[model samples]
Target: MPVPIPGNPLGYTLVYAIDSPKGPVLVDAGWNHPDAWAALRGGLLSLGIEVGSVSGVVVTHFHPDHAGLAGQVREASGAWIAMHEADAALVKLMRGFAEEEHHDFQADMLRRAGAPAEEVGAAAGQRPWVPAQPDRELRDGDLVDVPGRTLRAIHTPGHTPGHLCLHLADADRLFTGDHVLPGITPHVGIYPYDRDDVDPLGDFLTSLERVADLGGDRLLTALPAHEWIFPDVAARAAEIRHHHEEKLSTLAGLLADRAEPPTIWETAAMMTWNKPWEDLPPMLRGMAAGEAAAHLRALEARGHIRRVQGVDPVRFQALDS
Candidate 1:
């Protein structure tokens, strides 16, 4: 069922309802607005499932667009919610990140990325990193108790540390949340922490391969959160992986050709974007910098680049150059 996301161009999120012996199980709940709530209720009512008939909820990740109304649903239905433990912790961290220290941390992060004063201010308020408490914290390969369905949680941690994709091998389908989308490549970045420490891009690439391997014979259908259903889960994963690979190569080329070494912020500006670098909003630009830092760290790990640390904003160059 497509539940509307008020004020979003993406229109709505697909909240799949699976028939179980107990009651209906919803894969996701759209935005937690009155309009979105009505949409979900109406959809469920039409399906002969009451708003309170939902027995359980499985969030693919902790993003608000996907899990926004989850709390509301459980409140109404007494439904148990489950998510990977890493994401549960991330949600807590995100919700607590609205304090003065967190704001200062973000500003410092942007400064380290070489962002200007105005951009730093615009990017500082990344509030509402929200989630509800999960009744059960899942691990990789754990079998979810979605009555009558053999749904196994596959920890695909790149999109958001504890992001999960449910593999229903019995039905030959995969419920890929934001981990794998048909029309968009998931964003992976290092931020609010040491870029030298986290390698989100690397983790994302590896997770893609793992999910692709799960596809086995490529006969499975992919049911992504945002987009419509599609077939050939393996091919789609390969396409997304290659998309990131191309980005890695492009960044390596930029590092190789520069007259002077580039800071994370400078390299992000130099890299390609669907929109011109300067034209992107301040928040998105900050996100771009974080992503660039992730790629640089990944390349450093791969021995394709070397870090020139101790610079205010960290700098790097091609190792072979």
Candidate 2:
């Protein structure tokens, strides 16, 4: 029977305990909150699955919401915790960043994006920096053996460098973490810690195509972190792709407007939906502006745009001229 662990917007973490040749396997350890734990316990009790009955815990990623209480659960259930190896370093970095560096980075990035000093500091202060690490490492295509089920790991990096999704071959079900949301577009901004090869947006597009190739008829159930569960995966992927194309077009148009090009800040302001500088959220404003700059850089690399460095800010213009 499929048990829905309660407390999340998805209503419950869909956990399946099968009578496999081994024992039982737990998919994801949902958010680490008392309420989340209570709901999970209730769901398990309803299914007559005792804590000790759980044999293993497999996580999609190392995000707090997905792998939050994995260690605790592992200790309690005596189940081995498994995650992708690519994210192991990231998990460690997040721990340190949360305690000592995230606020400073956020403040610096916002300031660089032209946010007011005070607002930058305030927004940074409001950011939370709780971090935890994953236990065992999982790799792409690694098969996790459940009682009667087998989940194959698919490396879906975009939202995060180590993000993952699980494919259940027999059931044709996908357990997507934050990689694919139903309604909202996932943020694919460049992270300071990311390498030059980590083009989140590009990787995201590829990941979507991969998902599409996995047979369009499979059911996708995602833990939104907020909002309801959406069964339509392909539609959501298409929507995200369309949103990016629109953003890219808007950015290109902004660059074309200037004969001499403009600074990153100027281009960002133009690319944005003309939101008043003061009313926009500091983080969002920074993200939008930063992403616009990134898009311009990518365009320049492709010979589609030309870049000019000036005293005030760097600028870009379409290359046709």
Candidate 3:
């Protein structure tokens, strides 16, 4: 079911309901907005399923678009909520944080990424919604709590540290949340910007490879959380991986040609995007810089580049430089 997310560019989240003798288990709940809740209830009603009869909610990740309505669903039906252990931990941490603390941390992170004063301010203003706590914490290979179903979780850990891709053992179908979208690449960035060797891009690529090698069957259909569902999860995974490889190559060429090391912000400005970097808004610019930092960290992990020593705002250059 496509549940509307008001004011979001992606339009909606594709929420899946798996049937069981107990009740239907929701793979993802839409955004927490009233419209989204109404859509979900109505959509299930059309299928002869009541919102109050839902058995459980197995969230793919902690993102608002996916897990936002899980709490409400549980409230309506007395259903349990489940999510990967890492994401559940994140939820606990976030729920404990004060708004001012979160704002300050984000601002500091952007500053470390070498963002301009304005961009830092704008990006720091953006706050995340507190997610619902999960009753059941899942790990990779664990089966979801859907009676008479074999929906197993696979820890993908890229877009988020605890991102999960579920596989239906009975039907051979995969519910690839944001980990494998058909139309757009998911954002993967290192958070807690001061940590060394935190390579989110590297994790993303490895996760992609794992998904691609799942069964090697070309006809396996993948039901992603957004956009049109596509056949052959392996093919889509390979395409996304190739796109990142090309981006890594581009970043390498850029660093080789530059006379001095570039900060993450400058490196991001130099990379290609949908529009010119100058046209991007401050929040988007911050995101771009974080993405650039992930790519730079991946390169450093492979010994192709290194961080410049003793820099306030961190900078990276080719290893030979």
Candidate 4:
């Protein structure tokens, strides 16, 4: 069912529910807003299920849009919430953050990305909301607690470290959260922007192939969190991968043509986006910079580029140049 997210451009999040012996197990709960809560309750009622009677909630990831209402669901129905172990840990980490600390971390990341003073100021002070802790920690291939049905959790960490795509083996349906959306490519970014050790884009690319192989010979009907359901998850994965590959090439070429290496902020502004960088909002600019950082990290790992050390804000140069 579509749970409305008031004021959000994406409109609503599609929260899927599977009937179990205990009650209905939700694939995802919508955003945490009064309007969203009302919509979720109403939507469940329309399906002959009650929000207060939901047996369990299987979160796709820790993103607010997807996992925001999970805690409320448990509060209302005593439902058990499950998430991938990595994301659960992330939530734990976020729980320890003070509002100021969260704001400062983002502000520092923006500064490190070479954001201007005004932009850095604009990006700061937006407090982070920590989602409710998950009651159950799920691992890849773990069977969900849905009696009589075989629902398997596939850990597909890219967009977030603990993202999971649930597989309904009995129904041949794959609930592909944000990992494989139909119209939009999921943003694979390095959070804590200073932590350059992990390669998120690389993990994302590998995850795409991992989920694609789940189809094997038969096509798995994909039910994503946003947009309508579609068939052939593999094709969609390939398309998203190609888009990133093209983006990587564009970034590398941009670096090669530059006389001096550009900071992530500069590189992001120069790279192509749906809208011009000047028009992008502060939040979007951060996302763009993060996307640039992830791609640059991938390129560095592949020997296509090298990071320039001893810089305030990190910069990169194309080795092939």
Candidate 5:
């Protein structure tokens, strides 16, 4: 049985050792906190395994919660660390960007979105960036040969461009990272430096369909950065798809109400009426506005919305009108 880590919103972390012919391989390394590390070690010990027994560490993505202690584990167990190649660059980029550029980027984004100056300053203070890199790079459809199991990498970019989900062939199990969560929906906001060509939301939708095509019987387990293990994979995918569709409808309705095209900030305010601008944290407000902007862009691509560039800024409105 996988042990539950109390107080964690994701319920518990699963620390199971697979009996591979080469040795026991660990799926994900837990957090770097002393308590989290101790709990994982204790859980492994209860299963009659030791830290030295782990052969390799396979990560789904580069998020801190999933890959934070990977380096530490590699040092302790001599396990080779592996992650997606696309994400490897992100891991390196974020580490360097966090130290120098993250705060300013956060502040500027919020400031542009009409956040109060003081709120923007305070929100910039809360940005947390990890500083680490992966030792090995895995790619889409790459076969990770473990003892008695072959985990296939499925690139599921949205929440992050390099996000990956591992599918175990024989076990019929999929290790979904933050790509798909059972409880809370995953965040799919645009990165400040992200290329316009990369449609994360579209990629996410396609990835969900791909996972659904993998068969309904597949036992799904996830390492949600903040949720519990969920079994119903296909249903969850449908829920996410429906959620995005509904958001598009809502955006369309909002756009129809305004005679003049609305800026991203103005559109976002209509979308999040319950959460006032003054009360929202800077990062959240920026993310909310960005998400609205992404929806607008997607709608524009579909010919449902049109963008009009003004002297001062670009604005958007429903296309049919």
Candidate 6:
């Protein structure tokens, strides 16, 4: 089912409905906008299901676009919502934090990522959100209650700390929730909203290996959160893994420059972007920096680069430097 997100790059998110003994179990709830909500309801109705009849919801993560309607659905259908514990903790933290405090936290993060003062001041107001908390906490290897279907949760912690990919044993299908998408690589950047992330890119690479292993020869098609579905998830996994490996190598070369060891900002600017880095909007630029930082952290963790302190903006260099 297609549920639209306002001003989203992708036109809409695909919400998969599984027919179960109790009722239809939904994969993810769409955006919170009125039109988006309407689209979701209409889509469900078209499938001969009512909004109030959804039995369960397995949220892949706590991203606003994915979990926006979760609360509304639960209220309407009394459907039990389940998500990864890590993302659930984040949602709860957001719920507890005051608006001003949350804004300040986001502004501080922008500043840390080398955002200019003006953008930092306007960061929180750009798009504010508070996703509903999950009623159930999912962990790796946990099976979602799909009655006859054996849907196991794979905790993939790169897209988000609690990102999940649901494996359908009976159908040999993998419902990859922004963990793997067709044609493009999923962002493994740090969420600058709050808290420090450690080795996110590393975690992402590991998760790719795990998914590839699971899908080895028996895998069927991959149903991603966006775009079209495709076969050969393992081949796609290898492509993504190689992309990161090449990025690491490229960053290492840049860091190894004798005269100009780069800061995270410099590295991001110098790295090839889908579009010119300078042309991207402030928020996207900050996201780019966070992605660069994730790579830097991954390199540091694996002893490929050394971080230099005492500098105003901080800098990194090849470990041999």
Show pairs that collide, candidate 1: none
**For every candidate, C-alpha RMSD to the true structure in Å:** 1.9, 4.6, 1.6, 1.3, 3.4, 2.0
Query: Residue 207 of model 3: what lDDT?
Result: 97
Q: Give the TM-score of candidate 3.
A: 0.96
Instruction: Give the lDDT ranking, best first.
Output: 4, 3, 6, 1, 5, 2
Residue 105 shift from truth in candidate 6, angstroms: 1.6
**Candidate 6 colliding pairs:** none
Worst 10 residues of 4 by lDDT: 96-105
Candidate that beats the other on lDDT, 3 or 5, i.e. the better one: 3
- The numbered model that scores best in lDDT is 4
**Lowest lDDT 10-mer window, candidate 3?**
96-105
Q: Name the 10 consecutive residues with the lowest summed lDDT in model 5.
A: 1-10
Expressed as tens digits, the lDDT of each residue in 1-321 for candidate 6 is 989988978889899999998999999998999998999999999999999999999999998779989899999999999999998998887776555543566676776655667877886654347798788999999999899889999999998889999999888999998988888898888765222347789999999999988966686589998998999788898899999999998988877874756756677888878899979887678878888888888888888887776664557778788
Ranking by TM-score: 4, 3, 6, 1, 5, 2
Worst 10 residues of 2 by lDDT: 1-10
lDDT of 2 by residue, 83-194 (tens): 7887777777666767764357766655554555685677565444343455578788888766456678888887667777787777666766667777667666665411
Q: Candidate 3 vs candidate 4: which has greater lDDT? A: 4
Tens digits of lDDT, candidate 4, 99-198: 4454477778888888899988876766677898999999999999999999999999889999999999888899999999999998888876646689
lDDT of each residue in 1-321, candidate 1, tens digit only: 888888776788999888888888889888889999999999999889997989989999888788899999999999999999998887777667654455566777888777777877765655555668788899999998877789999999877889999998789999998888888887787875346767778898999989888966657789998878988878888999998889899989889998778888888899888799989877678778877888888888888998776777677989766
Clashes of each: 0, 4, 0, 0, 3, 0
**lDDT tens per residue, model 3, 1-321:** 999989878999999999999999999999999999999999999999999999999999999999999999999999999999999999988876644554566787888878889767765655668889999999999989888888999999989999999998688789999999998999987776545757888999999999887765545689999998888899989999999999999999999999999888889999998879999877677678778888888999999998888998988889888
The TM-score values for the models, in the order shown, are: 0.93, 0.76, 0.96, 0.97, 0.84, 0.94
